[model samples]
Target: MERTTLFHIFAAVLFLYNLPACLSRTSPNITTDQSALLALKSSVTLPPDHILVNNWTTTTPSSVCDWVGVTCGKLHGRVAALDLSNMGIIGTIPPHLGNLSFLVLLNITNNGFHGDLPEELVNIRRLQYMDVQFNKFSGQIPQWFGGFPNLVYLNVGNNSFSDSIPQDFGNLQKLKVLNMKFNQFTGFIPRIIFNMSLLELLNLKGNSLSGNLPANMCNHLPNLKFLDLSLNELEGQFPPGLQECSNLQVLSLLHNQFMGHIPSEIGNLTMLEKLYLGFNSLEGEIPNEFTNLVNLEILDLQSANLTGCIPSFLFNMSSLQWIELPYNNFFGSLPMNICPRPLLRVLVMAGNKVSGNIPTEIGNCTALTVIDLHENNFTGTIPEEFATIGYIAPEYGHEGLVSTNCDIYSFGIMMMEIFTRKKPTDEMFTSDLSLKRWVSEALVNGVTQAIDSRLIRQEEEHYFAEASCVSSIFELALNCTEESPENRINIKDALALLQKIRLEFQAKLSEN
Candidate 1:
């Protein structure tokens, strides 16, 4: 009888002792969450001695919530967020991550992660924000991504994802910011995406997306503020219905094949701040209606085959800052009363048919930093104020002649300034110690001594190769700035030399 009583006591003690662990393993929150996180840790290719190597161990006394890059919901005690941005972790995402049912945010930007995202991610229905930008992720974006009704921000930019964007993305009715730039997405933008009334920022730049934008694109996008479609193969007329986006602030459509006139209807966007329509096949004058954009800041229309005199109102707009209209057929002299706005900075009208004296009123623009008026019919000498800026070639001062060689000389000075990070008029330079003379003297010591220190790292493996490349550049600059125009290297030779230097430097880097 005593033996039976002892056996019963031992059984009760053992059951009591194992009760907590048994309950933990069986619970829906504890064991499942920890296992899911451990699966993620096992999947990624972390660096040796990474903090996650030590902090993400199950042997630690801390709970799963205490692991690196993991956050748990207080009430449910489930993983709610995982952010490992810029952690240098590599490898494909594991399918097991879909088990974190409570996860709302997943950010793995600026990593080396690659491969198609596991389709099981669709199970994370509660996901609201997902950023996998600046990674090597490839393959078609899974169509199931659009099924997340709660997703508000989605960015998969700077990846190699190809194929047409799925039309199902329009189902994300609550999505506010959608960035798919720098991918290989092709074909027409899905018409349904334009119907997303809540979308505020849409960036599809640097893709192979083709076809015309729908005419009714802005009709339902009432809240749209930023739209960028640059660097694509898209071709068609500029959408006339763009006026419907009353709240639109930035419109960038550069580097496309859009043909036809600048639609006057764009004048309706009074809130517009930036307008980029460069490198297209568009024609016609700046629409008079553009004068209505009192809030305009940047206006880029370079290489668009535009004709007619620049509208006078553009120079007078107080809000105007950047005015780039180069490589066009714009005629007529710059207005004497140009640059009324103190904010005017970049004024490029190069390769045009403009004539008459360079206007002195440009001096009114206190912020003006770039002024390109070359390859024009301007006949008079440069304004005295511009002559004093120290970038004018020496021949321009002595002979007062403007020729293509003078441009070559100026370009050499600019190149030296760029590599040395020193202005021609820097305080350290004087009449006998010009930037050109200083760099010329440094060649005897070592051209690397004259290079911008920020660009050089002696400890790097390719440091000497890079320094040799800089020396070649300086030699080319000196050739361009030879005293006699006849002795200067032509722009063609300079370009070829630069190409050779670049190839050689790349080869040396590969060797290292």
Candidate 2:
């Protein structure tokens, strides 16, 4: 009983030293909050705007509350929030901060504060949001973090904390967002966290957290809207309960070791707008059920082992803006009715075995901006309609056009490259038989041999129309490649001839 009395007496003395009003009529809460601000101020160095160095020193009733990045209660006059993010300050956190029992939000992100989080932080019982990310804080993630009674948002990503995620984090009953990415954390993800039913966004990407995810990952966190597990060592088949997540919007699992067929159940995630599953070992054909994802805008499946003919339904989805399925083994011809409405923007499907000629119906994709079709077995001439649409350009690497009429030579070369599907620098052409000489010789015989193989298969009218267009363009290209620059055809004449060829070609297409 004597010990209790003495302890109370000592505590009162200490409070008086810090708060300056422990035994006086003034409010101890505001004084204590001021002292806490001073404590944090002591650790900060190189305050750029003199925000902390000048303003936070004076603790008078109106002084500290009006300082930068500090918010005080309107009625109680106690510090309730501190936002010091990206202030270019350096120093470790001070332990004296537990005095700010009223602090509800503390953000020191993008600063240089390092070392283990002070144990006193657990005393901030009312802290609802805390972000210490983009700092150099190292050491185990504080285990006492479970003590924050009201924390709802916690972001300590981009740090060096090397601890298994505290299983006790499940104690944060109000937590809706937890981001701890880019840490050195290892060991199985604590199963306790999945019990947080209120979590809506969980980002643990860029960590070394090994071991497969818990099988019931989505069952408990039914409110999750954005989940990013990319750039980790997570293995095993994709999480099992993913299909049950009906509200997920952005699910990125790229650059991991996850294998197995992409689940057909993914079709059930109709709300997903962006799905990234690249740089993994996933195999098997894309499920036809993907057609149901009418709302999906971006889908990335690069660097996987996925196979089967490219599905035609992908072109029918009006909302798909970017589709990246490169470095896979997908085969079969491109769909004839590609992008039925002209909403598709980027379609990257290079580094595959896809064959057959590109369809002329591709001209319907008016919104298509980029199409990467490199390193494939596509055997065909360039589509003349695509060239007419200004999508293809002539190869001028070998042909020198140094005169005022250079544009004329360029246009003519482009015209020839289009019909023959052979660029000027093609390997088959030696100096003795350049692309110019080769095309000129073919024109002397007939336009048939120089024509693109794809065009050769067209019906009678197209074949004859293509032959006439090829003959005229080939003759113009030869005139442009004359030994003397001045002898080359002028730009005006070349354009006029090209325009006539296009009109005749369009007429033939119309007849067909």
Candidate 3:
């Protein structure tokens, strides 16, 4: 009787101790959520080859937390991170993913994930970085998004996300870089964005975002470095208070509806490197204060209604590389003493009202690749000594009326510069056949002969080579600058072809 009582007591204790584990085995939240996961697994059939996991041979009855790219927290064994980037994932985002309350980082960038973002995702309170860019995601961003107090970096760019930015976004004080570029987002700039003081890089380019940039836009964020509002319906002059953004580096306002002269004080941005104000209605002379921009690299005022001479201020910028002022009303002579800085690469001043003899000093710009002065009122004999103007012509001399042939000659020079990496003036000329003529002859024989010897070593021709892409680019250059203007390709076609060649070479390099 004593042995029976002792055994019964021990069994009772064991049963009582294991009660919680027993209850958890069939709990509704656990079993119900497991069924939901199974349903998600069935809704979208992943191809055999597309499955990223090696350990999980089948989707069967395994826990979702143990799946590839799904990380689980130690405390509750709940999903904490889902990194599904570049998996070529197709099908809608499963709302069942929100069942994991501990989920933090959700990255589905560079995939084919489509349809509306499920509202259930907002339950992920600890989410930090949500990257859904480069996908086909549509519909308005969920309003509950702002409730994710810890959300820091959100990239929904390059998608079909439309409608106004949520006003509640102001609640996400930790948000830093919000890239919504290349989307169909419309409506006025959300007032909520202006209140986010921590934002450093806000890119709304390539969207339909309208309304005047708030006058005090930069007043809230002193730490901003890159502010790209280009290719939008944003009108009104660049906000005057942007001067207070002392840390600003790149500010692109291209292809917008902005009018009036660019604020003269814009030169106060001493740290600015790339300033793109092209394709806007900005008129009047470039601010004289621009001369103060010592660090400026790219200054693109193309297609603006800008008037006056190409500023002498530009020639002084030693760090300058790209100078695009094409299609404006700029008039008067290019500076006579202009000597390009070593870093200078592109000089596009085409389709403007600039009139005067083509400056021979242009040949002194040894670093120049592109010198586009087409469609201007430029007169005088296309500088005959353009290939090697040993010295600057004494001011403007008695030169005659120029024809459209000047563009052809400039085109030839640009092509030679890109290939040979030598200025026309750098002892490259002596005979009647100009640089263009030499390249033309080589192309006729075979482009291999025209390849810049600098691009290859003495005896390494048979191995891996940059030859094929270079050959194609060379042929393109030869076709662009045909002496008969009618035979030459248009600028648009030329640029597109060059870009294509560049991409081809880039792909080759990446693969190797």
List lDDT for all candidates, in order.
0.83, 0.77, 0.71
Ranked by lDDT, the better of candidates 1 and 3 is 1
Tell me the spans in candidate 2 whose CA falls farther than 4 Å from its real position: 1-26, 47-49, 59-61, 384-512
Give the winner by TM-score: 1 or 3: 1
Candidate 1 vs candidate 2: the lDDT winner is 1
Question: Of 2 and 3, which scores higher on lDDT?
Answer: 2
> What are the runs in model 1 whose C-alpha is more than 4 Å off?
1-28, 388-512
Query: For candidate 1, lDDT tens digit of each residue in 86-118?
Result: 899888888888888877778899998999898
Estimated TM-score per prediction? 0.75, 0.70, 0.72
The residue-by-residue lDDT of candidate 2 on 325-346, one tens digit each, is 9999999988888768777767
Candidate whose TM-score is highest: 1
State which candidate, 1 or 2, has the greater TM-score.
Answer: 1
